[model samples]
Target: MTMPFRLTVLSLAVAATLAGCNRDKADETTPPPAASAGTGAVVTPADAAAPMAFESKTAFAEVSLTLPVAIKAQPDLHARLYAAAVRDLREFSEGAQADRTEAGGDEGLGAYDKSIEITPGAETGKLFSLVRTDSEYTGGAHPNSSFAAILWDKALKREVAAADLFTRTGDLSALDIALCAAINAEKKKRDPQAETVSLTGSDMWKCPRAALVPFVLAQGTRPGKAGGLVFLIGPYLVGPYVEGSYEVTVPQSAFRSLLAPAYADEFAGEPKPEHAGA
Candidate 1:
């Protein structure tokens, strides 16, 4: 979490007093450090400057962005990632405003707004996760939001998707079946009120392999030795949006057989025992 930001546009000019508007207010300010060896223009927290902010407000809507401290630690990697996040936010905000304006500017629009918050997650060796959460309110019955947990291979400065963690078996039907049961089991285990539901052959059972890409990852024996891969599924993915978001954690064991050789050791779970017949 960084500093609280405010971006209000439209005729409403949403006053700053709006609830939960100014959340992260920056305190200490720092500057980018001198370039280091191979890091190029990257800077660590110590040398990184304060959050960069962008704001726009009109009678019809508002748009604002507070950049996370750019890393520049690995060439332009940090900056590039941050830029992508910012670009998404900008498009969400500005696009809505444009659409509304074309529709003759809703006479009763209340704070057509959008905001993004970035936070750091698990980091082991050169692998790290950057979690981005977006919350926005157009003229909807409720606010719309989303979360993306990106696992990055910092050493290589690229993103790691779920498929990359496994070997291409040409067919993932088995993996899909196992994950659905696992997700349903976890859900019921955590929720006392949840019914014992069989996800097999159900639409809910279709847990996209992509859904296993972790928002947060850590060491464990379940999903793999690398730990549990927790995929955050928003409303409508598993259930209606009003039902809220859901998390299905596929332990390393769930797909151990499919684990890529490169990732197998990292995601290895408990060792299988030798057969007594042997």
Candidate 2:
């Protein structure tokens, strides 16, 4: 069986690290390769580089990303704290009191099933959330999907709520664009044969259909680790900001909640297949 893309890569890289702890950190010093043909600028780092992986046991997908200096390698001010927040959220799912089931119609795909959303707020700190969702097939031959969301601090430390998190950090415009390009480059390497390229908003990329959307990178430190954080950079969709338009007109609040600690939750409940729509 094809393991979730993230978990498979995570296992390999974890094994590699355990087998040889002395290997140089990939993101610390090495320079990343040039940007794709026409996406954006490249990112490099200040320390030695190392290998990193993102995985999910239920998603049947795993992706390996470089820890090169540019984007993944930087030692942000809040990196350690952000990492802890991610770990906490992951733990929350295992012991959460509320496990509500919700479903709704989503574009591209019809309905999402067996989902739970959690919002966490801290006194004098940022806002963040944990969300877990699963998509199952009704008639079409699509494989089931499980996803988690997480938000971290500016330095990438403790996870915070969306309400407080953004206020504490700088505008993510440039960072968002740079991250999309980096992830796009990684996907290209993973599936060099993948055809077209489409970038929308900030981070989404149409690796196959040329559809683009906003994307973001979520980084957190490993549980009990000293100086490193796990980075999950991928395609994400967000509401576009229009000139002279009210921000409240869109679901920015909900989307932000889905982005961070939301990734830390668990979606291990057995999924129930439902009747498809006509």
Candidate 3:
């Protein structure tokens, strides 16, 4: 009885193997179906998520948001960033359309464009710092550009604002002074004829409050550590629109004591040479 059962199993296995081989042979000879005329192009996940432009007789608008490859490697972070970009683009496009309608321009309004690019700052074991620059034009005399910082916690998989990394008792006044000095120096270098503005002045030309400005972590000589902070001062913040934007970097040594205990170790050394004055 046992021998008969074993023989039956062997016969079934051989039959299955022969059937699989026949299918493979048939598949080899069978030509794959051609893609539909309009569907021939392949779209990757990133390509599918690319920002779309809005064009109409009344208005034309477009947005471009770019992220670093490293940031895109994280699924949750990538999705959040992409969703936010899409939302912003959508809002801007809608607003442009509405403005055109309100203006009642038969020839259509001017085009609106917004471009955002995110670059890597410092990528450590526990944190990833990024800098985002935004250039936008919305019926203004000239396009305006600004900067923003995004700090992501690897363990928590979420964004951590720069303000949260400091202690409650941290003395940011010193950092402010440093930033003010740097701005004045850069201003002097750019236009020797132009006079440097006072930090105590209550005008647009006065030095901007460091805490209020957007800042990103600067890369340090030591691997896996932040060298310092780079304050992003947009036009009209610290000076006239003609002065444009400024990237002032303050070394970590200047703000070492101001950092919270948990974040102190994340910073070390000085700003890389390439990022020093620029």
Q: Give the top-scoring candidate (TM-score).
A: 3
For 1-278, candidate 2 gives per-residue lDDT tens digits of 11256986787787676657656655433335754424464432311121122222222211111121222322341233234434543443332212212222222343222222222211112222223233333325443433344444423345444333233344445434433344445444455754323444334433221012211222122221111111222222221111111101111222242223433221111111110000
Model 1, 1-278: lDDT tens digits are 22222432331244333323654754222234565647575544433432355566766557666545524343344555556766776677667778877888677767578777766544555566666677778775887878777677766667777667668775556656655665566556566565444434464534445434344554453342345455566665554465576655555565677767765666544322210000
Model 3, C-alpha of 252: deviation from truth (Å): 0.2
Better lDDT candidate (2, 3)? 3
The per-prediction CA RMSD against the true structure, in angstroms, equals 15.3, 21.7, 11.1
- Best prediction by lDDT: 3
How does each model score on TM-score? 0.64, 0.27, 0.76
Worst 10 residues of 1 by lDDT: 269-278
Task: Indicate the residue-level lDDT of 271 in model 1.
Answer: 26
Off by over 4 Å in 1: 1-56, 63-75, 189-216, 219-225, 268-278
* Shift in Å, residue 159, candidate 3: 1.2
CA lDDT of 150 in candidate 3? 80
Residue 235's lDDT in candidate 2: 24
Clashes of 1: 30
Q: If the candidates were sorted by their TM-score against the true structure, best first, what order would they fall in?
A: 3, 1, 2
In candidate 3, position 141 carries an lDDT of 83
